[model samples]
Target: MSWQIWFVYGLVALAVLLFFSGRVRLDLTAALVIIALAVSGILTPAEAVSGFGNPLVMLIAGLFIVSEGLARTGVASAVGVKIAALGGRSERRLILLLMPVVAVLSAVMSSTGVVALFVPVVLTLAREAGLPPARLLMPLAIAALIGGMLTLIGTPPNLVVNRALIDAGRDGFAFFDFTLIGGCILLLAIGFLLTLGMRLLPQRTSAPSDDRHRRLHEFAEHYGIGDQLRSLRIQAESALVGKTVGEAAMRREHGLTVIALQRGRWLSSLNPVLVNTRLQADDVLIVVGRPETIATQTTDLRLSDQGFPHGLQRRYRESFGAAETLVVPGSPLVGKTLAQANLRARQRINVLAMRRADKPLEIDFQDTQLQSGDLLLVAGSWSDLERLTGPRTDMVLLQMPAELADRTWHANQAPWAVLITLLMLFAMATQVTSNLVAVMLAAFFMVVTRCVEMNEAYRSMNWQSLVLIAGMLPLADALAKTGGADQIVNGLSALFAGHGVYVILVGLFLLTSLLSQFISNTATTVLIAPIALNLALGLGYSPQAFMMTVAIAASTAFATPVASPVNILVLAPGQYRFSDFVKVGVPLQMLALAVTVLLVPLVFPLTRT
Candidate 1:
């Protein structure tokens, strides 16, 4: 072997160690690998940096925009609500309903975000529907892992393989390429959990339910300001449409407290309504004041009284529909109070009560500084209330009243969202346009048709994901350029000489899946894909089956919380032990392996001999 091969080998090993160490970010580690190769003269500077400009990167980014459009129009959450409704408050049935629904959602959007949004809903179901959090969460996590299998943009690994095929001078996988195999696998997964999987899950204890009818309690209990918490929408010709919260001054003249400021229905996001944000037609105001005062100003203010939740109208000792939000550890609002953090002025939610360590603090909550894990019971419109769901969110919503379910958003722009997606799929499947061009066009139409906002399109992208894939792409090029990929493939192929192609498939699946349980699935795919492709060609088999094996194995990341972000999101709330994941995940991984080995050959034949 040449010195260059030895050097590449050492660098690949070091990069793997660093990825598992968790000390450095995966993208940065990938960047280091690219720099080392470029500096060592194994790859030219242009080759080292070529990955960032790849069309696959653009395709992924454009898909993120299309997904944001789906989310903005309430299409995604509406799907969740519909499927959840099918559960009918039954514990076992809800698990059956939630698992497939979540899987389907994850097939389109980020699985991590889908799990984040549903965590609170799952917790609520456990408490009210009398289910164990563990029983529901384990399936939720596993279903999300399976969801990534169903579409072209379902997971990053699928795209990595397609890029590998394209780089090898073959056509990339079509948009619906994975649908047949992946959809079959998804049905099997759903069946597995519905039957044997739940028995393996821990029957952990459930948490207590919260007060759902206490929203107006802030106004009635504190100041006797109003008997009902009311919402009013400004009409197109309303005088309040162009005014800011401060200018409206409902508190001074109408004895009304501005609780939340909301945006238009066609727009995206459940963010808090800000005080300084100018009101638009259809902009809803969540306010607390005397019913008569609000009614008197409705006509004069040129507003439409949107009415409060059903429970709020007849309720008193309790508050209006309330949700508990947790202050995440790294949140910038960690040390600030309601007033200092400007929660009201910015997100426009009022803090009714604060609790730490399960004990309610009797001090003035508005003046009190919030620490990590502090839970605040907040009141606002259901649409404005569902905003805080992910690790990036400042306040993680824990639970919301069931009354809001009836008032939740729907799939209004669903047809447009579906049309754009289908157009992209047709372009890819038919090869009429490049994958990048197809997705970008779909993304453009999504925004022009008001399916997604401009800002949200940008936010939907996971830059680290894009950078991680871009940076790691050069490693494969370096491997092939420096003869490292050939060396590795030859050594492994010789070790299994005289063995059938099925043996190689099993080895690749096991190696990739095992590594994926510790490092990320995408990184695992990037590192192993080239070798799998090389191995197939040497054996006179087409790269088709081998590449498919690598992509599917890369997604078998069920062994640990650290395996994927979706697992970690559920860990604390599920109160699962590391052993808990392994207890169930190990068996599931074995099931996937059997399924892949049996299915891959049937789907993509290796009969090149």
Candidate 2:
């Protein structure tokens, strides 16, 4: 082999190491690979950057917006509520119903989004059903992963493989081409999860019920802040009468946190607490501090302590709400102090308190640097709280007060969102337009119809995934350009020289599935697709069977918590250890392999037509 092929292989090895190390971001690693390829003169600048303009990237972005439309307009939440009602406290029935529902949803939307939508619902169901969350969450994650195999656009790996076919001057896969095989695998997984998989899961203690939907007073008591929450009226002679919250320095000087303000006679109308909010002579301040400190401040500041009113909880619930949010890994907010995040200004919400690993932080936590898995108690208007439920990188909504269940922000547009999604599917399935055109139109309609706002459409795009895909495409191009792909395919062929094609298929599936257990499956698919295609052509067989095998193998990221983002999303909530995934996931991975080896040749035909 030439030095260029050796150099490309070295870069791939380093890239895989970086992915496994978890020290550098996946997208950054891809970007560095792109730079190395371009600067190494293995490929021209145009070839290196060609991936940015790939239709697959645009289609993925458009799908994200469409999925957000369903979420923002309450379509997905409605499905979750219906599932909860149908399951009704039976562990067996819940697993039976939940896995299929999640799988169906994952067929259309991103699997990660589908899991995020269902996590809170599944947690609530577990609590109500008297079952450990461990019993249900693993099924949910597995179903989601299998569901991606259900449609051509179901996962990025499918698209990567399809793009390889199209770029090779062959007809690309149709919308439902993957459905037959994917459907079979999903059924097999559902059965495994319902029986043996259920036994494999640990019956750990359930996640805390306090994280479920609760009333205001319940939330206060759970956080151990009930005694700290007090109401005081500002007297005319009070030094804080005309001062802003920032100017009064209540937290700095008095060690009190003003959480809400009531200005008018009707106590129900609570104004959002903000730094620029001014205090009036008769304003009632709902504050959080030690009881003794509050009493002392009442006298020193010339204010009257009007112990919390009988209807205070009701009034607070009507005007403001509280929720528990988990700071997810890789959040930009990680390592920033609460004061630096400025949630009150940016998100229109205030951080009331924080809990890390089930232990509450100190009172002076404003300057505390945040970390992943920190559960925060935040208070804000119902509208702002509703925004937290949307897709965000900084935090995941663990639970909201029950009052939000009846609150409808975009419920009216749900039918339109569903209609638009169905129409987009119809267009793609019927071949009326290209898949890319159909998806873009659906995204445009989602915005024009007010199902999702313009700004939200932009925010819904997962830029990191998109960049990673674009950046890694050039590496695949360089591999094929530098003859690296041919070398790998030849080695595999020689190793399996006397073995039948079925053995070769099983070998490729295992190799792809193993690589997927650590790195992004999409990147794994990008690097392996060209090699699979060339190997099949070299063996005088059709490429479709090999390409489909590669795609299915890439989605079998079931054997580890770090395998997929969906698995990591459930790791903490389910209280699962590394061995738990191996116990449950390895069997499922073998099941998928068996199904793929038996079905791929039948579905796509290994023999040249």
Candidate 3:
């Protein structure tokens, strides 16, 4: 073998070691591969960086943005909620109902995003049904992985293999080419999970129901402010009609703290009680104080008594929520009083109560000096509360009320998101434009229609995954250029020289599936795809069946927690161990291998056209 081939082999071995160790980020490892290849003069700089401009990378990026649009607009959340309702407290029935819904969504959207959207929903289902989260989360992850096989754009591996075929001077796969085999696998998986897979999962006891996620009333009860809660509406002729919340002096005169303001009729609008929030006629103020003090103050201030209605609680849950934030050591607010810190004016959130030394402070606690390790209960619109989760030096958000997940930011825009997604699908299925064009148009429409904001569209991208794919593409090219791929294919051909093509297909599937468990599936497919193509051509058989098998095998990352991002996502939440995956995942992997080997040849013949 030439020195170039030897060098490529050495670099690939090192890259695989780094991938398995995971000490370096996958994208960084890919970057190192690119740099090594370019510096060794094996590939020119332009050739090394050509993968960045590849249509496959752009298609993946566009799909991410489109998926984010659906998420931000509440389309995915609504689907999850509707489907979860059909389960009706039966663990078996929930698995039957939930897996198909998740699988179908995963076929169009990102599997990781689909899993994230459903995790909380599934947790809620498990809690309501009196089942352990472990019982359901594994099935959810497996369904998502299988869902990726349903469409050409469902996963990166599908695109990688398609690009390889096109580069090999063949036509690429159509949009729904993967659906038939993928649907069959999904059905088999659902059946397995409903029966044996459920028994294979661990039954770790879930956190107590009360401890899972407390409601608004539960939070008020914990803080001892439930009895103090009151609501009052402003009279038209009242003196405070035009005064701001700070100027109203409700706290100083009546010993009542204004928590929020409801401006529209029927409590249609709710906002955090910021200092600049101006009071107006018919505006309702949700306040906390003793009944005697509140009654006397209302009579004097010309405010009409409006008892706290149950509807207001529903509105509060929908538009506003509370969160617990801890003042960490070295925080700038550690030594300042709540009034001096001015969180209301700056963050537009009310500090409803504070806790120190594991006990709730007195109601009149704003003047109290803040200290490290102090926990404050703050109230705000859900959007503002979400912002606190970002990078901050003053305080860290410890927990949010569970109802926060039900709050939707752009519920009104949901129809537009759905329409745009459907239109994109129609375009792709009909071949009105190339797959890349269809996806890019959808991404553009998502932003133009305000389904997702411009900034959010950019933030929604998984840059790490994109960089990893782009960087690794050149490595595949280097392998092909230096005859490294041919060398590997030659050995495989010799091993299977006397065997039937079906045996070789099974071997290829097993090898791809095994490598996928320990590395990025896209990278696995990129390295294996060219070899599969070369092997098929060298054997005088068509490459379509082999290429299709490679793509399907790369997605069978079900046997390990570290295998896929979706698996890692559910690991901690489900309280799972490594053994739990092996107990369930190995059988599923074998099932997929059987299905792919049996089905691919039937769908795409082995004869070269």
Candidate 4:
């Protein structure tokens, strides 16, 4: 290899490390890699930029826009809400309903898209059904992973590998070609999840493992604005010592939406409106809604700083307009009452809301408190706020308001939209039309018919993944062109030379599984597809079988957030620790590995050497 290639290799290694470390954003890491490749002359500026416009890359981007359109129309979220209602009372029934639905959607759309849309829904449904979120989110993520493996255009990784194989002069596997083995593996994994997987999850871990999230400390800081959540002694003049939330509401007529009633530390969401539920002194009412609304209705209600939006600008002058603020740990207002913070007056901004890592705010607006990792929704000119968060070492602004695209999805023509989208996917699968053409037409139709607005369509696409794919595709091509693929194939073929083709098949599956955890499925597919073809050539085995193995393995990212974007999304809502994934995921991974290993060799047997 030349010095340039060596340098490229070093950059690639560093990029991979940073990707798994989760320190920097993935999009930035991908951008840096492309920049390094361009500077190192591994790719010309034209070649480096060409990946952005690649048809496959464009297809992925377009699909994201389509997914965004669906989201805007409330179609996807509506589907989730409807599914939750249908699951009925039984947990098994719920799994049966959600798993297959997620799986099928994943097969047609992006897994990340499916997860983003459904993770919240699943969390909400689980809490409503009174089941732990840990029981459902793993299955949801895994099903999405498996569903993508079922078809050619199902997942970005599958598409990347399929296209890479075709680009390398081998005919790509058909859309449904992976379905038999993939379906078997998916069914088996789902069964394990429903039967044994739920038992392994940390049942009701210290955090609210249910999707409702409502953590006590965070809620107290962010939403508990007033004496709605009082921990007070029965003073000589106090009026609520024995009066319940219902009694106070009926008498005081305050617009208090009680999230929960806590008496002597016992919390209950039941009978929130019943005035007869006797309340003792020092009992807390975790309420929701506006502070002024609460105070005007209730008597002697001293406002506290429970929901005094943390992580927003604490001190904003007029110059702090349209900028960003970061929330640092151990700041002056870390645990202080919002009233004490004088957030509205001193900061000259409105504390809109706060999002905590562990739970959703449950208490009424009058009584929440701020906590660490609380993303405070503040309304102010960004330039007016000073940098209390820190320069480089403290809690940083993870996202800015302007950077957040408005995802106000609206589904105007729901039936026609879904029908046309399905037809397009079907055409792509059946070979009646190319995916590139079919999806493009679908997008065009969506625009011309006003099913989705042009700006909304443009805004919906996942530009990050599109850019990453575009950058990596050329590098993947270079790896094949540089004889890097052949080197890898030779090593693999030799290692499994003595063993039967089954061992080689199993090895490929495991290798792809590991690579997928570190890099994206799309990157894994693009890089591994060429090598799999070479391995088949070396062993005089079926190239189709090797390709299928690579395709299947790349889609099964069940182990960690580092494995898939969908996993990262549910991590917070599922209230899952890193270990929670492994505890449940390892078994499913092993099952998928075993099933694919056995089934692929049987279905597409290797020729006798």
Off by over 4 Å in 4: 1-5, 88-96, 104-141, 148-180, 191-412, 458-462, 500-502, 512-551, 557-588, 600-609
lDDT of 3 by residue, 1-609 (tens): 999999988997887677656477767887998899899999999998887998767876787788777767666655544555677678899899888888998887667656755775676567546678899999999999999999998888999999999999987899899999999999999988888887898898555554667766677777767687778899998888999888987776668778888887532366678787889999888887778888898988888888886546545665678888999999999889988998878998878788889888865887788999998888888988889999899999988886774565665677888898787777764567876887889899989989889998898777776776678677777877998866775676578657889899988988888767755788779888988888888889988899999999999999766577677667656867656777798999888988998899999988865
Model 4 agreement with the true structure over 24-43: per-residue lDDT tens digits:
76567767877777786767
Instruction: Report the poorest 10 consecutive residues by lDDT, candidate 2.
Output: 403-412
Off by over 4 Å in 2: 88-95, 102-184, 191-217, 220-408, 500-502, 511-587, 596-609
Identify the candidate with maximal lDDT: 3
Kindly give the stretch of ten consecutive residues in candidate 1 with the minimal lDDT sum.
Answer: 311-320
Query: Which should have the higher lDDT, number 1 or number 3?
Result: 3
The TM-scores, one per candidate, come to: 0.52, 0.54, 0.61, 0.54
lDDT of each: 0.70, 0.80, 0.80, 0.60
Error of model 1, residue 100, in angstroms: 4.4
Which residue pairs in candidate 1 collide? Answer: 213-319, 214-318, 214-319, 214-320, 215-319, 215-320, 216-320, 272-347
**Model 2 RMSD, rounded to 1 decimal:** 13.6
Highest TM-score scorer: 3
* lDDT score, candidate 2, position 460: 75
Question: What is the full ranking by TM-score, best candidate first?
Answer: 3, 2, 4, 1
